[model samples]
Target: MSDKPKTPLLDKVSYPADLKGLSREELKQVADELRTEVIDAVSVTGGHLGAGLGVIELTVALHAVFDTPEDRLIWDVGHQAYPHKVLTGRRDRIRTLRQKNGLSGFTRRVESEYDPFGAAHSSTSISAGLGMAVGAQLSGKKRNVVAVIGDGAITAGMAYEAMNNAGAMDARLIVVLNDNDMSIAAPTGAMRAHLAKLVSGPTYRGLRHTAKQIAKALPPIFHEPARRAEEFTRGFFTGGTLFEELGFYYVGPIDGHNLDHLIPVLENVRDAEEGPILVHAITKKGKGYGPAEAAADKYHGVNKFNVITGAQAKAPSNAPSYTSVFAQSLITEAREDERIVAVTAAMPSGTGLDKFAEHFPTRTFDVGIAEQHAVTFAAGLACEGLKPFVAIYSTFLQRAYDQVVHDVALQGLPVRFAIDRAGHVGADGPTHAGNYDSAYLGAIPGMVLMAAGDEAELKHMVATAAAYDQGPIAFRYPRGDGLGVEMPERGLVLPIGKGRILREGSTVAILSYGTRLGEVLAAAERLAAFGLNPTIADARFMKPLDEVLIRRLAAEHEVLLTVEEGSIGGFSSHVATYLAANGLLDSGHLRFRPMMIGDRYAEQGSVDGMYGEDHLDRNGIVATVLRALGNEAEAMRILNAGRD
Candidate 1:
C-alpha cells in the first residue's frame, strides 16, 4: 500500500478561485481530505500539529467562500495555516515543512499568493489585516478582507485596537474568532469570560437586538432615558455588545468543527455589505486528534512523532535542554525569594514558564502575546518592589524594544529578563532567531547582559539576575540541549563584569560569550594540534565587557578576537569601541573580527548548516582569526572556509 494520502478534491484545488465551483457536499469531502493530509504530513515532519488540525473545516470554508489572493486572508500567529498551505499549492512539499530550504512552519508571503500578509508573531494579524482592509478601500480595490484570529490571540491590546478602529470605521472586514477556549495554556481574563457567556447563551442576541430597535423608534422626550435603559439592558444580555458598539455586526458562538454551520455563516458574512463583522467560531485546538486534544497545551506545536502511536521520537540523551535548565533554576530562585514573580507574553509553555506557573499559579502571569505590555507590566511590578522575571524569547523581546528602553531601563527597574532562544534557532528560521538581543540590550544604560556557555553557567546567570537589584538585567540561552555539563544543585552568583580564562596563549586571544564557547574551545583544540596556542577567554557579561580580563589579554596578545552569535553592533563591535576609546588600538596589531550572524535574513536549516552558511561556525571563527593574525596561508588550511 502507498503512503500517499487520498487527495481527490485537494489535488484538484490549484487555487482558491477553483474552490467556488465546488458543491457544499464536495467541499466537505475536500475538508476531510485536507485534515487527513495535514495529519499525515505533520506525523512525518512534526511542526505545529495541533493548530492546523483545529482549523481544517474553517480553512476549507474560507477558501470555498472568499476570493483569496484577490481578497486578502491574514492568518493570526500562522501555526494554524498548515492546512491553508496544503490547499494553496504546497501539499507536495508539506513533508519538508520546517526543514532547510523547504516549506515554512508558519505562513509566508513568498510561499503563496493566498497569504496576503504573512505572520509568525501572534496578535499581529488583526492589525495587519485592518491595514490591508483600509489600504484596499483607499485604493478602490473593494475586495473582501478577513483576519482569522485565535481566541488565545484575541487577548492582546493590539487586537482590541484593530477591533475598536475597524468597528468605528465600519470597514468591510471579517474578523473570524477561532475560539479554541485556550491559548498555549488555558485562556484567562474578563474578555475570555465575556466570550464564554456569548457562546453559552441561547436567545440573548435576539432579545438584545429587538430592544435596540424598539429604543431607536421611541418618542423624542423618552429617547434619552430609553437609550440609557437600552444601553444598560444591552450590556446585561449580550456580553459581546462591546464589539457591537465598535460597529461590528457580531454573529457567532457557532460550532467551528461543523461544516453545516461554518459554511453558511462564512458565506453570509462574505455576501454582506455595510460594515465589519465578527463570526465567533467555537473550535477545539486539536480537533479530530484525540491525543493532542487530551494534552494540556492542545499539543499546540509539537515535535516529530508517530501518527498512530502519537508518540514523539525518543531523544538521544537524558541531558536537560537549556529551557528546562532555566525553568529549574528559576524555580529554585523563586522558592528562596517570594518577591520573584514570573511573566511571559502568551508563551508560558514555550518559555518554560509553565513549570513556574504550575508551582506558583498566582505568581506566574501569562500576558497573552503582548510583548510590549509584558515589558511595561514587569516594569509596573518592579515599581511596587516586586522582582519580575520577564521570560521572553529574544525574537519576541524585539517587539518590545521601546518598552525595554523607556519603561524599564529609564526608570531603573530590576526586571530580570530570562531571554530564551538567544542564538541561531534551527528550522523555525530567521524570524525566530535570537540573533540581536545582545546588541539591542547592550545599547541601554544600566542594562546588564549575560549569556550561558552551558547549563551550569545558565544556573549562575539566573542567580546573578535575581541578586542584581540596581537595574534591569538579562541572561540569554540557546534553544536546544546543553553540552551535558554537570549542573550545580544550587546556583552561585558570579561577579558582574568578570570572566574566566579557559586557555592561556602567547600570540592570539579568542574572547567568546554564551553557547559559542563550545565552538571556540573546539577551534582551540584544532589550533593546538598545529602548535598554535590561542588564549580563549569566556566573557561572561556583554554590557560591562569584563574590561579587566580583556585589557590584560589585549596587552599581552599580539592579536585579539571577539566572538558572539549576534549581529553587527554586538559584542565584537563593543569590544572594538572600548579598545578604541581607551587608546588600546594598534596594540598587538589588534584584530577585531566578530564571528556573528551577519546582516541577512537567514533561511531554515540545521544549527551547523545555518552557522556554516552564515560563516559563524567554529571553523569560520578559526579562519577569521587566522586571517586577522596575518596568517592567510594558515587560514586556507582551516577546512570549512568558503565564499571569501
Candidate 2:
C-alpha cells in the first residue's frame, strides 16, 4: 500500500462534479494522475487494466461534459469502467476491487448511482441506453444518455439491432464507438480532430439542420438528390457512411486518448440537440502504460504484479490448469482425426483454443465476439461430417442458448462443446461465474453433459466426445488446476452414460458431478474422524445419468448427498428427478440432500472461499454429512471451523 502512486490532482476529485470547473489543462493533469492511480490499483488487485486505460480520457470527458447521476452513461462490457469507478466516489475502495466483500470487477447499479446499468458481458450498451433514453423521454426528464462501446463489442448483432431501433425511433442517445483495437480506418491526425470538432460543433449541425429544412421544402426529386449529395460529400471525407445509413449522425475518428481532442468534441456532442449520434474515437488499448501498450491481451486481465518491472505475480500450483489440459487433450484427439476442428467465440486463449490453434492453425476458427454465430457456424461444420469443437466460457455459452438448441441439440448435431470455467470464477464475480450452464444445457433434449472430476477424467471426456457421434455432447471443467492425480499418456475413450465409484462405504454416499470430487474425497477423509465412512462416486454425466448406479447407491446407503459446483437446476436437480421418478423418495428409509450453489448469487472471493461460503467445499461437505447423520452439533462445529 505504501508503494502506491501519488495522485495529487486525483486526490482533489471526490466525484465527477469535482471535475466541472477544472480547466482543460487541469483536467489533463487529473487524467494523468487518474491513470497512475488505476495502474497502481490494478498492480495490487489484478483485473481488466488495458480497456480501462484506453478510456481514461473518454471517461473523464463524459463525466465532465455531462451529468452522470442524472444523465445516464452505460459502459458496454464494464471492463473499461474502472477509471469511471475511481472518478465516481469509489476511489477509497479502489484497491479492494475484485476482492472479498469489496468493489465488483464490473459496473453494478447497487454499487453506485453513477452506474445506471450493470454489465460484465459485452455489446448490450446501445440497447440499454436506448431503453434509458426512452424512459427519460416518457418521464419528461431531460438527460443525455451515452453508450460507450468498444469496436469489438459493436460487432455483435445485438448492437446493430439496438442501433437500428434507436435510429428508427430517432431517440436521443449518444453511441461513442471506442475503436481501440479493431482498425476501422486510420487517418487520425490534426485534420481528423478539427473535422471531428467542426462537425460536432453548433455551426455545422445548425447549417445541416437548415439545409434539411430547405431540402424538405424543395420538389421531391430535387430534395432526394440534394440529401444524397450532402451524405456522399461527408462520407467521402469521413468513413461514417455505414453509421449514417443506420440513422445516426457520425462524427470523429478523433484521437480518444488526447484530452484536448476528446473533451471539446464530447462537450459539443453534449450541448447539441441531436437524436441518435455516433462518435468514433480512436484510442489504444493500453494508452499510457508501456507494458500494456506493448501487449494488449496480457494486460487485458492480470494477476497482481510488480509495477516497476511489469511482472505479474504467479500463484504456484502443482498441477496444470484445466484450460491447458483441455487444450492438450483436444490436440491429442485432433492429431489422430483430420476431421476434428475447433471454434472459439473471441476467447481463443481463455478457452484454450489458442494452444489448439498452434497445433492446428487452419482447423481452428476464432469468430469474433459472436457466440450465436459461432454456434451456428460449428453446426454447419458438423453437418458436413467434420467434428467441430466449440470451446467457449460457460457464461458466454449462455448467449448462444437458442443456437445450441435449434442448430445443434434439436437437429442432433455432433458438436463437441469444451466448456471452460464451469464453476465460480473467483474474483471475476457472479457475472462471470459458470453457474447456470449445467442447468441450461442439461434442460436441452438429446444433449449429453459431462463434468470432469480431475484432469485425467477431462482427458477421458475429450476422447469420449471425439469418439461419440450420436448427438451434441458437452464437458465442463473449472478454471483452476487439476488434482495432481496421475496424468494419462493419451486420452482414453470411456463409455457414455456411465460413472465410476472412487471409494466404498455403507451408511452414507457422496455423489460428485464435477471437480468437486476432490473436496468430496477430502470430506470423506475428515468424516472418518466423526466415525462416518461415506461412499464417494463420481457421476461424470449429469445428462443420461447412470441410473443403475443411482438405484444401487440409493438402495445401499441410508443417506445420499449430491454435490456440484453449478446452480440448483443442474446435476443435483437431475439426480433428484431420477430418484423421485423411481420411488426412491417414497420409502422413508433413505434421506437425500442435494448441495449446490445457493438460490442467490454469491459474492466474489477466492475459488475456495466462495465454495466454502456456499458450503460446497471439503469442510462444507463434512458439515453436511454430519448434519445429515443427525450430528447437528458436530456439523455446526465443522462448518464454523474454516468459515471467516
Candidate 3:
C-alpha cells in the first residue's frame, strides 16, 4: 500500500453524526478528504473507483442532511457507495474491499446497518425504498426512505415501475437520480439549481399548497389547468416532466459537485411532507481524480494500481480471453452471414460486443440495462429471420428468464444466447458468479444447451448456435482466458447432443462439462499414478443428456462421475436423471457421483481458490475420484493437503 494522505477533517469524523455538527464549509473539507480516501483505498483494493469519486459530495450531503439507519438509505447498484462505506464506520477495512472474507465491492445488508438494502445489480433501489416507506407508514413509524439511482440505472423499466407505484400510493419516498454519465437532464447550471431549490424549498411548496386550497374552492374545471400550469412551469425549468408525469415532484438538474446546492435541496426533500419527490443531481464520474476522469469508463472497475502514476497493475496473459475469442469468432461468422447481429444489456465492452460494433456498427444493439427487452428484441429480430446473439453474463441473464422462456423458447425462435462469465467469477463475489445459466435454461423444453470445454470448443459452440435455427439455443463460456489450447482455423458445427471421450479407461468414467474439462484431464493423469486410470469425456450439451456416451461410460466402467462448474439441477442433474431412469444406478455394481458447485454462494477470491474451496478444482476432482474408487484414506489425504 502507498503512504496515506493527510486528512485532518476526515480524522475527526467517524460517522454521519459527526458531520451533523460541522459547518457547511467544514463538511466540504470532509467531502474533499473523503474523495482522497476513496481514491487511495481503491488504488490498493482496486474495485469501483469512478462511482465513489463521482458521488463524494452527494454522499456527504445526504448523510449530513438525513438520519441514516433509521431513515433507510439505499444505493442503487451500490457502485457509488464507497464513500458511504467509509463514512459508515468501515474505514478501517476500506482497503480490504472485494477481498475474500472482507468488505464487498457492492452494498451488502449484513455488512453494515447503514446499508438498509444490499445491491449489486442495477435499478432496484426505488422499489425497495417504496416498500420500506409504505411499511413504515403502516407501522405508524415516522421514518424516511431514500433510494439513490444512477442515470444508467434509471433507463431500466423497473425504476419507472417503482416510480409509478410510489406516485399512485402517495408514499413518502425520495428518489435521487444521480446523473453521472447519461445526463438525464443535461443542463446543470446556476439557473437549474435555483429552480430546483425553489421547487423543493419550504416557501415555494407552502405557496403552492395555499394556491391549491384556494383553487379547490373554485370551479372543478379550473383545477386541472391550475395543476398543469404549476407542474409545467416547474418542469419547464427542471426538465423533469417525465418524472413529474410518473407522479413524483421533480426537483432539479442540480450540480452534484456543489455542496451549497445539494445540502439545501436535500434538506428540503427531508423536511417536505410530500408523497414522493425526485431529486436530479448531475455529477461528473471520476470527479476529483485526473487519471480516472481521463479514462473511458473513468476507471469504473479497476485492478490495483500505483497511486502516483495512476498506472493499473495488470497480469500478463499468454492466451486470448474467452470474450475476445467469442467477439472475433462472431465477427468472422457475421462476415459470412450478413443476417447475424449482436445485442448486449448495457455491457458492450464487458461482453466483447464493442469489438463487434467496430466492424458491424449497424448490427450491434446496446439495450441499456434492460436484459428483458434485450431478449425479446432479439426474439423480434429472429422473427424476421435475422440471427441474433444475445450476449449476457450468467447472473444478469436471470433478469430476463421470463422473456427467455415465454418470448424465445415458447415461440421456438432461433435467438442464440452467448452466455459469458459462465461460472465462478472471482473478486466480484457470489453476486457476479455465473453458476445458474445451465440449470435455468436447461429446464425449458426445446432449449439446447452447450458449455465450452475449452476456447476451441467455445468457437465450435458459437458456430453451432449460429447454424441451428430450429429452436432457442445457448452456449456458455467462463470468465477468463481459455485452456491455451490450439485454436481451430474456423469453428465447426458439432452434431447436436453428443459428447467426445478425451481418454479411455476401465475402472471409472469422468463425464465433464464446461471449462472443468482441463481439471478433469489433470485428475485423470493423477489417477494414473494411483494405478486407477479414469476415462475422461467432455459433455458438450447438457440438455440432450448425451445418452449414448453416458450409457457407454456407465456400461464400461464400474464407477461413473459427472463434473461441472454449476450447482444443482444443471449438467450433473440431467446425467443423473438419465442414468437413474435407464436403471444405471440400480446396477449395484456401478457407483455414481456428481460433482458440482456447493449449494451456497462462493465468496470473492481467486477463481482457482474458490474452485478448490468448493472441491471443484483439479485436486478436488482427484479427491472425488479417489473416494469413488474406495481409496478413502488417499482421498482424505488429498483433500486435507489441498485445503491447507
Candidate 4:
C-alpha cells in the first residue's frame, strides 16, 4: 500500500501499443496497477469480479508478450476478459459494463480488435482458436493464436475434441491452461484430478527437455528406439501422456502468478518452432486479494459489494430469489417422493441445487460441464422409474437440446426440468441471456413447458412437475429476486395447462407468462387510466396451452395480446400456431400481436434498463397494447356505429 496514492500505468494504457515501450520490470508494475484498477472497476459496476481478478496478471503478461490485435487471443468464457477489455481501449467505458447500449461484460469481436473470438459459453475457445490458427497458417500470416482456458472449462467434450484435432493437424497454436481449481462451483469428474496431476504437480518439465535432447542425438537407424525413449520419459513425468497422445507438446505446471516465470514461459511457447503446445499455468482463483480468496465462489460473479469487508452492499430482500424458491420447493417435493432426484451441470449455487445436495446427497448429481450428459443421464434415471429434476440454466441447456428432444421427449420419459435464468440475465450480456429455452423446449413433442409469473406460481409449477408423470416436463423462471408475494408454506401442485386470470376487462386481453407478468400488469394499469379496460391473464403453461381460455378470450376481446420473456419461437409463437390451427385465425380481426424477445441478443444492464431498451418493460408493453387498440393517440376516440 503506497501512501502517495499511486496512479495506475494500466489506466494510462488504452491499447497494447501503449505498453510497447515499457521494460519487462515496468510491465510487472503495470500488472499490479491493472489488478487494482480491475478490482476498483468491478466493485462499482458489479460484474464478473473473481475471474477478472484471477486473470489480471495473465492478461498483462499475454498482452506484453503477444501482439494482440494481430495475434488473435480468444478467452473461453469471456468472464475473465474484463482486464483485457480495460487494456484494449475500453477503460473509460468500464463503468458501463453490462449496460444496454454500453460495453458488454464478455469479450465481443465488435467491442475490440484484440478479441478475435467472442464467447459466453464454455469449452468453445479451443475450437475457435484452432480454426483461427489453421486459417492463419493457410493464409501465410505471421501471428500467434492463444486460447486461455480454465481447468474447469476443459471438462467439456468439445475442448478435448479441439485438442485432438489441433494435435493431429499439427496446427501452430498455443493453449494456456489457466488452472483456477474452480468453475462456478468446485469442478467435478476425472478431468479435474488429471489436470491437478499434470498442471499443479511438479515433474512436468525435466522430462520434456531430456526427451528433446535424446531425440536430436538418435541416428536414423535408432529413430524407432528414440521415439520409445520420449514416450517412456513422458509417461514417467508429465503423466498427461494424454496431451502427447492428442499430438500436443505439453509444457508447464508453471507458476502463473510469478511474472518472472510466466513471461519467459510464454515467450518460449510463442517461439517454439513447430506443432501445437499446452502451457499449464497454475493460479489461485481469487489471487492477490484476501477477501476474494476467502470466498472465491461467492465473489465469482457478484453484485456490488463493499471493498473492505467483501459484503454485498444492499437493502434487505423483499422476497427470496427465484433460484432459492426453486431449490427449497424441490427439496420439499423430493422428501416425500423417494424416486425423485436432482441434477445440475457445473452449477450448484447458481441453479440452487446446493440445498438439495445438502439434504439428499446421494440423489443429487453434478455432471461437470457436460450439459449433454446431464440431460441424457436424467432420461436414464427416468427410464428406471426415478423422477429426475434436471436443474440447468436456460442458456446452458441449449447445449443439450438434442438429448432433450431425442432421449427424453421422444421416449416420453418423466424428466422434470427446472430451467433457471430463463430471461434477460444482467451483466453477462447476450451470450448468457436465457432467451431460447422456451421455444426449443416447446417444440419438442411430448414436452410440457411451463413458466412462472411470480415466485408463488413457481412453487406450484415445481409441485406440478413433481406430480405429473405424463411425459418430459419443464418450468422456466428468471434470474434475481422474486416479486414480494407471500410464499406458500406448503407446496401445492396446480393443474397442468391451466392459467389464472389476475384481472378482467372487455376491449382487449393482455396474456403474459413468467417474469414479464409484472410489466403486463403495469401496462394494464396504464391502459385503464386511458379508459381502456384490458383483461390481464397469466398464461402459465407454454405447451399444452389453455386452449379453452384462449378461444374464449379471442371471441370476447377485440385484441388478444401475448407477451413472454423468450425469443420469437417461444410462448407467443405457440399462441399464434394454436390460433391458426383451431379456426380462431378467422375470428374477425381480433388483432393478435405476439410480443417476445426480438431478433438481436439482449445486452447486460440494470434489469429495468434492459427491459426499457428492448421494449420488454411496462411502458413498452403498454405502448404496444395502445397501438393495437387504435386509441393510442386519443384516449377518447370513439368507434363508428355499425362499422362491420
Candidate 5:
C-alpha cells in the first residue's frame, strides 16, 4: 500500500467552486493541504516545483475570491500553474504530469475551462487577459479578467507593451505581479532593481493612507488633480510612477504568502471598477519546502527525488552534456580571441553561458527575458567589429526572428548564433521544442545553417562560426548529452558547405543531419544483417548544401534517404529542392526519401519516446529503408518485431 498525505480539507473540495462555501480560516488550512499535495505530486512527477510551491497561498486566494471559469485567470509562463491545476479538478491525473497523453506541464485551454488561455512562453498572460477583458466589455459581459504574471516574466518587453495598451484603453484587467524575485535564472536588469526598491521601501505602506486623504479632501471638479497628486506622491515614494504612467492602478508590495493580507486585497481588487490594475505581491520562490528554499535556484525545475532527503535522482551518464561542451568550447575560443563576446536573454545557466560569464564577466551580457533585444544588441556589437555569439534556446530564437532578418542577416552582420535545445525537448513538451528553427532560418537568404552530429562536431562548428566573418551563421545541437566521441584539444574549422561520409556501402545512402546520425548508424548496423550495407553520410551544413557529395551519392546509390531532427521544410527540404532543381530527382534511376518530424505537436515524454512515436528511431529508420527498397513485407516484420 502507498502512503498519501492526510488532506481531509482538500478531500472536501475538488474544484474552485467548492472553496466558496469554506470559511476564511478553513481556506487557510486548505492552502496548507494544497501545498502538501503539490509537493507530493511533483515529488513523484519531477516537474516545476518551487514556482508552484511559492504560489500556493496566492493560488488559493485567487480561486476562493474569484468566480473562475467565468472569471478568466491566465498564468504567464505556466511553470507556476501546477498548484492551479491541482485546484482546477486535475488532482486525479496530477501524477501523470508531463507524461505522454497525460496532463500537460503548463496551462492549456483545451484541458480545462479554468485555463481560458494557453501559456508556455512568458510575458503573454497580461496581453491575453486584456484581450479577454476587452472582448467581455464589447459583449456586455461583466466577468473579471485576471492575469497572474511572475516578476521574471514581467521583465520581458511584451509584458510592458501589454501594460501600456491596457492602461491606455483603461481596460478592466487585473494583473497580479507575482514578485518571487526569480525566474528560471536569477532576475536581472534595471526593472529588477526597481521592483526590489518598491518591495523594501516604506513608500508602499504609506501610499494607501495618503491616497485616501487626497480623495476625501478633493471636491468633484478637483478629483482629477487630486488623483494626479496621489499618483505623483505614490510614484515618488514607491517608484510606482512608471506603472501609473503606463495607466495601471498600482496596488501592492504586500505579502503574497499571508492569506490575512492576500484575501482582503484580492477581494478589494476584484470589486474595483477602474482601469487596469497592477498588484505587486512579494513572495518567496520556495516558501514551505526547506530543501527548495535553501537551494540557489529554489529548485525551479526538479527531477524525481526522495521526499525526506530532497535529493533528486538523475540518470548516470559518462558522456558530457551538449550544454557543458558548448560552454567549455566557447570558453576555449574566447581565451584566444579578445574580440569574442557572449549574450543571453535571462538564461545564463540554461544556455551554459554561466561558465563563460565566470571567465569573462565583463564580456557577457544577460538582457533579461528580451530575446528581440538580445539579437539586435548582438548585431549592434557586430557593427562595431566584435564577434558576438548569441547563445539562446531554439524556441526562444523564434521571438527574435525579425531582429535576425532585419538587424543581422539583411545587414550582413557576422553574428554567431549558438542555438541550444535545437530539436524536441522532452518533458517541456511542444512549447519548448526547437522544431522550427531549421525551417525558419533556412528560408532566409545569406544565412549559413549547420547542425552538429556530435560534441566534437559542435566544437568544430563553434570554431567555424568564430572564424567566419561574412554573414550571420547559426549552428544547432540537441538537449541531452552528446555521443561519446573522441575529444580534440582545439576545434578545427572545416570547409564551408561540405559533408563527410561516415560509412561507404552499395545499395542505399542515408544522409543525416544533427544528432540523428547516431540512430542512422544503428539502423545501418541492423541493415547489415539482411546483407544490405547502406552508405551513411553526415551533412554538417544544411544551408549551402554539399552539392558535390549529394550528387555523387545520388549517382552511386540506388536510393537516397535524408533524415533530420527538425520538422518539414528544413534540411531534407533543401536537399530535395537541390535534387529537383539539378534534374537529379527527374532521372528515373534514383529513389529519394526524406524523413523528418511529423506535422503535429508532440507531447511531453522522453526524447527517444518522441522520436519513436514520430517513426524516426533506429527501428523506424530500418523500416523506412526496407520499404523504400520494395520490401514492404520485410519492413512490416521489422516494425512489428520491435514493438513486440
Candidate 6:
C-alpha cells in the first residue's frame, strides 16, 4: 500500500556478496534501483543527495568486484557514501539519515564495519587507505585497500602527500578518482582544469586493449617495456602523466554511470597485482535526478524535499543568518578601506564570501580546500599592510592551526579570522562541531578571541576586527539565524577586554560568552519567576578575561556562573583560572560554576535538541542556578520537568 518505489533488485541483494551472484545486466538494474532508493531516502531525511546519486553505479561496481569488510574501502569526505551504505545492509535505516540518534550525514566507522576509516573532512581517504594497505602488507594479511576520492578532495595537499608516500612505499593500493568536476562548490585551481582536460581527451580504450594483447604475445623482457609504452601512450593522449609519475598504474577515463564500462575495469584493477593503481572515472554529479543535475551546485546538500517537485523544505526564519551578517559587515568595512580583502578555503558561498566576491571580485580569493595555505596566504596579505579577513568555519580552521600559530600568532600578524559555526553545528554531527576553537585559539598568547551575542554584536565584532591592527584577532558566531534583534545603522568597535551588564541583581550573576546569552537571559527570567533575579553580563572578549568586570562580579555576587558555547577549557575555564589564580576563591563565600559542553562528543540533531541534551538550554541553565543556590533536589526536579 506504500507509495515508495519498488526496489526488487536492491531488496534481493542486501549486501555486496549478494551482488556478486547477479549477472551484469541484473547488476545494472540494481544500480538504477539503488539510485532511486537514495533519492527517495534523501527526500525523506534530507542530506547529501547529489553526491550519493552520482556514485550509485560506482558504489555497486566497487562492492561487487572487491571484498569489502575484508578489503578496506575508504570514501573521501563520505558525502557520497549513501548508496554504499544502502548496499551494505543499512537500507532499513537509510531514511533516518542526519536525524537525532540515527545515521550520520557522513560515513562513520563506528556505524558500520563496511566503513574502515571514518571521514567527514576531505582528502583523508587516500592517506588512511595507504596506511591500512601498508599495515596489512607488514602484518602478512591479504586484503585490498581502495580509496575512493573526488577530484575536489585530490586537489588538497594532504592527498598529494599521501600519494607521494604511497608511490614510494609501493604498497598495493587503489585510488579511485571520482572526477565529477565539482566539490561542494565548483572545483578551483589548475588541478580542476587538468582533470577537465583529461576527461575530454582522446579515448584510451583502443590503446589499452591493443597494449594488453601485445603484452600477452611478448616475452618477459619485452613485457616491462611494452607496459611502459602502453602507459606512455595513454599518458600522452589522456594526460594521466602526473599519476604515472607518482608510481601509480593509471587506468581509464571510463564512464562511471555505465555498469558495462565500470564492472570490467574494476574487475581488472582488482585482479591486477600492481604496486598502486589510479582509476579515473568520469561521472555526472546528481546523475539520475533531473532537478539535482540542472541546479548550479547539483544540490550537494539539501533539506527534505518533495520528490516530484524537487522543491526543498526550508524552515522559515525572520532573522538573517550569522554568515550573511558577517559578509555584509565585512563588505561595508571594505567600502571605506581599499586594503581590506576576503579569503575562503573552498567555501565561498558557505562562508558568505560569494557576496563579497560579486562586489569586490578581485579582492575575494577562494583557495580551494586548502586551509593551511589559506591561513599563511592571509598572513602574507597582512604582512603587505592589507587587512585580510580569512573567513572559515571553526571546524575547517582546525586544519590550519600550525599556520595560525607560527605564521600569524608567533609573528604577530594582524590577519582577521572570522570563525563561523562556532558552536555545536547540528545535523553534520561531532565531526563538524565548531566547539573547540575558543579553547584552542584562546591558548595562543597574542590571539584576540571574541564571540558574538547576536547579529548586531557580530556586525560590531566584524568592525572591531577590521579596526584592530594590534595582532592576530578572531571572532566567532554560531550557525543558523540571528536572534531577530534590531540592526545597527553602522557597526561600532567596542573597547578591547570589555563586557556590558544587561541586568543588575544581587545574589547570583550569570556571565555569558557568545550567542548563549539568549539562553542565559531566558534562564534568568525563569529564575525571576522563582523569586530569584540573577545578574546577566555579556563578556565581549574571551582572551583578555575582562578581569575588572569578573573580579567585581565575583566579589559582589554569592554565586558566579560562567557560560559559553564551547568545550571545557574555553571562556569559562579562563574565568575559573583567573578567579582562582587571583585568590578570588580563598573566601569560600563565592560558589563558582562553569557551564559548557561536556567531555563527550555530541550526536547530530536540531540545534535546540543538542543544547537541551547537553543541559545548556534555558531550563538547563535555570536548573544550574537552582543547584548553585543550595537547592540540589529542586534543580533535579526542574530539569526532570521537561522542555520549556
lDDT of each: 0.82, 0.92, 0.91, 0.82, 0.89, 0.88
Error of 1 at 389 (Å): 1.1
Off by over 4 Å in 1: 182-239, 296-298, 637-644
Tell me the tens digit of each residue's lDDT in model 2 across 1-644: 57677888899999999999999999999999999999999998999999999999999989999987889999988989999999999999999999999999999999999999998899999999999999989988888999999938988889999998998875779999999985686747899899899988999999999999999999898987888898898888777999988999999889998878988898898888877999999889988999999989888899998878899999899999999999998999999999999999889888889899999999999988899999999999999999999999999999999999999999999999999998999999989999999999989999999999999999999999999999999999999899999999888888889999999998999999999998899989998887888899999999899999999999999999999999989999999999999899998999999999888887899988888888999999888888888999988987877775
Supply candidate 2's per-residue lDDT for 55. 93
Judging by lDDT against the true structure, name the best candidate.
Answer: 2
- Going through the candidates in the order shown, the clash numbers are 0, 0, 0, 1, 0, 0
The alpha-carbon deviation from the true structure for residue 581 of candidate 3, after best TM-score superposition, in angstroms, is 0.6
At residue 527, candidate 4 shows an lDDT of: 75
| Per-residue C-alpha lDDT of model 1 across residues 470-588, encoded as one tens digit per residue | 99999999988888788799889999989899898878898988888888888888777666799999998988888888889888887787777888788888888889889888554
Worst lDDT 10-window in candidate 1 = 182-191
lDDT (Cα, tens digit) per residue for candidate 4, span 448-542: 98999999889989999999999999999998889888899866888788888999899899899888998888888877787888899999898
Worst 10-residue stretch by lDDT in candidate 2?
Answer: 180-189
C-alpha root-mean-square deviation, candidate 2: 1.2
**lDDT for residue 176 in candidate 1, whole number 0-100:** 88
Sorted on TM-score, best first, the list reads 3, 2, 5, 6, 1, 4
Per-prediction RMSD in angstroms? Answer: 4.2, 1.2, 1.1, 5.4, 4.3, 4.6
For candidate 3, the per-residue lDDT at 519 reads 90
Q: What clash pairs does model 2 have?
A: none
In angstroms, the error of model 1 at 233 is 7.5
Across 1-644, the per-residue lDDT of candidate 3 in tens digits comes to: 34799999998888889899999999999999999999999999899998889899999999999998899999997978999999999999999999888899999998999999988999999999999999999999988899999948998999988998998887789999899885465755788888889989999999999999988999999999999998888777678899888999888889999999999999999999987999999998899999988984738888998878999998888789999999999999999999999999999999999999999999999999999999999999999999999999999999999999999999999999999998899999989999998899989999999999999999999899989999999999998898889999789999999999899888989999999999989888888888887888999999787899999999999888899999898999998889889898895888899999989989998899999988888888888888877889999999999889
- List of clashing residue pairs for candidate 4: 98-604
- Model 4 scores a TM of 0.90
